[model samples]
Target chain A: MSTLNEVLTKNLHGLYYGNRILLPFKADILKAVIEKSIITDFSDFSEQAEYEIKDNRTEIYFYEYADLSEFITTYETIKLIVVEEGRDIFDIKNHIKLILHLNDGHEIKIEEAGENFLFIE
Target chain B: MRKILPVVLLAFLLFGMTNQVNASDFVNPAALSAEIVNSDAEHSLPPVFMVIPFVTLLLLIAVMPLFAHHFWEKHYPKFSIALGTITVLYYLLVMNDTHSLLHTLAEYLSFIALLASLFVASGGILIKVDKKATPMLNVIFLLFGAVIANIIGTTGASMLLIRPFIKINQDRIKPYHIIFFIFLISNIGGALTPIGDPPLFLGFLRGVDFFWVFEHVWYMWLPTIIVVAAVFYFIDSRNNDGQEKSKEYTGQIEFKGYKNVVYLLIILISVFIDPNVISWVPNLYPLPFGIREIIMFSVVYLSYKTADKEILSSNEFDFEPIKEVAYLFIGIFATMIPALQLIAYEANLLGDKLNPGIFYWATGLLSGFLDNAPTYLNFLSAAMGKYGWDVNNAVDVHNFEIEHAVYLQAISVAAVFFGAMTYIGNGPNFMVKSISERAGIKMPSFFAYLIKYSIPILIPIFILVWLAFYYGRV
Candidate 1:
């Protein structure tokens, strides 16, 4: 192989985003992100969601945002999604779902907020 | 209480501006129309003093964002509108060429429409780079941009690539990555076709064949891209922290809103349709620009209506960038009219000394400061004057393209390439900077960027092109 990067760029470039940003990932990182990253703030535009989170110990910052509303909601179907899709909803896809809550009621969530319920900051 | 002053002033400025917007509402027609460049049958050159507003206003775009950051950000639209109003009044009253003004506005509207459509459509599609921020990967990204910039237009390609470029390289992003991206993708990549950059598209409007740049400038583009990518690789390799953070994103790369591509294609197709001449307006420029504007706007609407709002949300797309461009370019396009007329007059004065090398340096240097679209027109018009061609006639411009191919080539390259030299040189440079800053990349300042990165890297590459293409041809 000339290089995986060479192949990746060529194949990835023809897709929707076409900038090689549509990165494929494992199911585990999103779990790590949800737990280890201390979400300092969260907001979204209309159905889009964004969270300002920092690594719990290192204090490093990373952001998570997606307008995944089309695929999610409290419409009596979230439980079905959880069962069928599992935590892939929060996987590092182009978008991630808003949150997850434990049986003990501890919460991990992104708040939906902003101007005219529209735009990104 | 804090917002009242600006709100009051905005209202005052808006009212005052609306009252006096006719073509000759401000300037004394008898005094200022002496050296008019015949835009049509009876149009004259804009007065020399008009450059003051143009230069000062453009300078303020770069300067105010630094020292007066908060105040400038809040008041920039007003500032832009106020400066644009000066030119509108001058054009209406002093020159009394309503026909030329309308023609310019028509062209201006279409120009803004294509840019806005690309911005919105491209922004609607999010690209998430899962690759690690390696030197090799960054080079690949830059090369892809360099190729695609010609297809989508620099602003379009820049909007698509900049975020993902920033994201993938977020950890190791030094000043060089962003700077090189600007140099290669935002400016130089657009050198080969009218579809690539605004200046070249204007050349197309005046009848230069679409394929002319590909035939003439492809030789220039290839080596320049390679050399720059090599330089970027060297710099990036030296800075690698020896930590292997290269990891794949954890899910299959996915997409939403791919249909927006159809809208983008529609916008591109509209550029080919010739608009009808508004005969009653009298003294029209050749391009039926109004038709293109209508079609591009319609595409923008169709894309918005059809794409799920989720696509826009996932991409974090917004309209603020376009609004800012619209307001500021009105100032830029309007005020630069006189400056161009003056440059044309001076170019005419040079007579036969208008060599290809002269055209190259002159057009390139001005593009770094003034927006390149008009700067290209200025030098091209001047070169036409040297060949005794008519500046207002499309047929003459086309003729100049044939008779003085080398000079036309130089003008095209200079206007498109050197825009990477400064922040305001191209529309997307500032937008990219703005977006990157939001993503937490602290970009270099205007003077600092030139002194350090752009001048060192780009000037040498430009010199090579000059030596190869234009040294003896003029």
Candidate 2:
């Protein structure tokens, strides 16, 4: 299993390169992090952590950690499954779910709620 | 922006005081009208019944969208072409008027060429104004749009600016903002130059000088723009409470696809490459299209092909709008021939009884209802007939401008200005409305547009223009 940082690096690389959809806020932060080399081995990120595309959805599985600061640079990816790619978030269906496997064996889901993303534990 | 207003005002004052150059200083008006009446008897006119196709097409254009929208939208091309075919067949089989058909076809080709090139070129340009929306800024934007309409044409300027206009005013973008945009940018702004509007361009095709409209209409255009913009400023200021407080603006203006500016200049320069204007320019007679048209159509292909894909995607550029214009205008140009001939004959019959004031109201009202391009030509044909000149003859058209400046001015002003009164009045009005609606603005309905916005706002302004310039003038 890849480390949390490695998984996030893969996720960011996959989202930034593979997928066309990027949250405007996260896109800015992701750009800054990559540009400043705040995350090491970012250039080689695609080799480690991999995201899965299943059915109509993009499934990115990552284990949750204790400190929120560790996930600060981790970009929240909202995959628009029902709508066409590159459409605004407002046009998206509510079924966008990002599953987070927690350290204590509990799973949490982050869902798109209207204009924002909602975290449910 | 603030500093430019005083200079514009001073220029307007100077233009208003400048004495107009009259080329026909020796020609007597009474003798000319009498002579025109006598000369009209030589050519046998088309039967009045032949005009039904043109009228039917216009009526269908107006009512079908309101009443039979689905049917209209699905099969407008068929109906438009069918009606046009009837008129063309009648002219060919009955009247045997091949010359009228060919001439109109030439005008149609030229018309579509200019519009298509401008539409294609301007589509590649994306202007982003990242600033807080203020009433003054909005007014200035509208004024700036008015000035450039002459350069890029109203259709081009509308396509380039409407999206940015909406984005900047997204927080407080009301339907009136769009209505005023249609008024100033789409219609009224184009009055000062032939390149600005379709009707004026048609005048140019028939042989009006390129600078003639500017020399005559600028004094009138300036005050009208100022007044309408002032009214917009007043209304915008009153409705300024609802902007989002959290949003920050960098106040930077960005332009993408700057290379298209060179293509735009190419189109502008091609406007003057007419055989009639430049003696060296090859005429290519009987072909209906000259060197000018060839250059314009080439630009349409070249600009679209070479345009930056990113800017094209951002603007959501597509051929649908220009395609619609091309198909509908082919029908409009074809059908209007009979109506123009009949109207011209009758106008010559009524001679001096039909004054500049009558031409103003008639052209203005009909233009508001029917397509202004055809209405403009119909009235222009009428005015030319009243002067005993054939619209087909370039020399007659040239002389008509110099001799009967008032009537032509009235028709020209009314055709360009009153087009803002209705959506169907001009091409860009509907395009602006559709684009605004796509952006989530609930634009007023056709009647709602007339009753609530245009009738109240534009009518008073049009009346003021008439009073200032065209009132009681023969």
Candidate 3:
């Protein structure tokens, strides 16, 4: 397996925005991500809705930036595995959606506030 | 008010500097207009003293901010307008040069309109990046900012991205990051396209092809960007302690204010709406501006009025940065006419002795100190004059481009790249510095930025570019 640093330095193109580094995967990596079943959806919308990957409390949202057609098609194939796992996307306490730790001794807390996402950094 | 008194006395001082022009001259304006504005008339060159206002203004810009920050903050607009008025009165009363004055006014209007519209429009859109501050990630961000600078202009890209950049590096944020941002994104990045920098836009207005700069300067620009980015990467890596505990990251990115994107597109498209480019576009001649400027100013008003308040608040959007640019640049544009004319005369007289290398250094060094846009114009006027061509004439400008592409390339690259050398070199450099300072990033003083960062980091890269591209090409 290629290291995350190698993938980042070489193939993967990323633009940093909001509370996440948007990693737009392409071709072989996209295929590997699908075939290896790395990103499993956890929502009931299943076939029609957006795709996301759950890793601990961090939720990578795919409702933005990525426009690759394969990204859309990969959603349908990946939804079934997520249903089998029966994992909840929102399992964190106090409605805190995400927590980001900065190198300069700062912290960013992303919370779900009604229809809005509040970022306390 | 007390402010108006000095301005009026300064106006009298300006008139006192000039020879007598009777108030009765206004009654029969046609004779004065015919005598001055006629194409065939042989006018005397602007006296050397006329250049003082421009030089004084530039000196004040470089010195006052460092020495008298509070006073400069409160009265910069007054200073700018007063100096600009001196030049305007000198031209109108002494030199009787309405044509040059009018032409310069048109350029200034176009310049400010484009900058203001981009500023207001980009102010509405906010990008929020939630990522760790790593050397690699920072390099990528700088690289991306450079690319986008060509599209939205250095001003637009800097305003849109600087906030997110500062936020992302909040914990590890240092002065070097902001300085590199000023160097790469606010200056050198804009060399590839006319939309990228004010100097190139002025060149475009004067009749250089839109893609001409990209074609000529990209190879040089790419290598320069690489060298600068590499230096930044090395510096950044050493600064990294690698002690932060790894936290789970979702890689989330949020972008707000989609309407501003459409507004940006409109601004970009409007750039090509000049009657000079499209035949159907109506020419609003005799007036100092055109259809393009009108559209730009309209977008400025509309974008600000309709912007989302939440996005504006989050970005800390205010008109102060653009206002400073507007006031300062109006002074620069007005005062530069005499200097440009004098330089053109000298360049023509010494055309044979002056080569591409000489033009390159002359333009580069001056651009680092003076506002790069006018410096670009000054050198361009000089170069064209060397070929016995006029910068104001479209045919002459196009012909000069065909005959002397290398000189244009040198001036174009130098003006844009060397602008990174100082806070006053480009409009966005100051804006970025102000924005960073407000965000609590202690930016370097003017001399410190030059002595520490630009002279050390940029000069070597610029020398390499010169040796590679403009060495012995005359």
Candidate 3 clashing pairs?
Answer: A17-B128, A17-B129, A18-B128, A18-B129, A18-B130, A19-B130, A20-B130, A20-B251, A20-B252, A104-B171
lDDT tens string, model 2, B228-338? 999999999998643545677798998888889899989989887865556787656435567878899999999999999767755546565565666666676667665
Residue range B203-265, candidate 3, lDDT tens digits: 886789989999999999898998899999999988854337365555677899999999889
- lDDT per residue for candidate 1 within A1-121, as digits (tens), equals 2122332334321111110111121211121112112222323441211322222111111223222232122210110011112244443232222222121121112222211111111
lDDT of 2 by residue, A1-121 (tens): 3322333445422222221222211111111111001111213253212234343334332212233223322222222222223434463232232322112212222232221111111
- Tell me, by DockQ, which candidate is best: 1
**Stretches > 4 Å off in candidate 3:** A1-121, B1-42, B205-207, B241-248, B388-403
How high is the DockQ of candidate 1?
0.04
Interface RMSD of each: 11.9, 17.0, 18.2
Q: State the lDDT of candidate 1 residue by residue for B84-115, as single tens digits.
A: 66776776667765544444454456667788
- Residue B29, model 3: lDDT of 12
Locate the minimum summed-lDDT window of 10 residues in model 3 chain A: A27-36
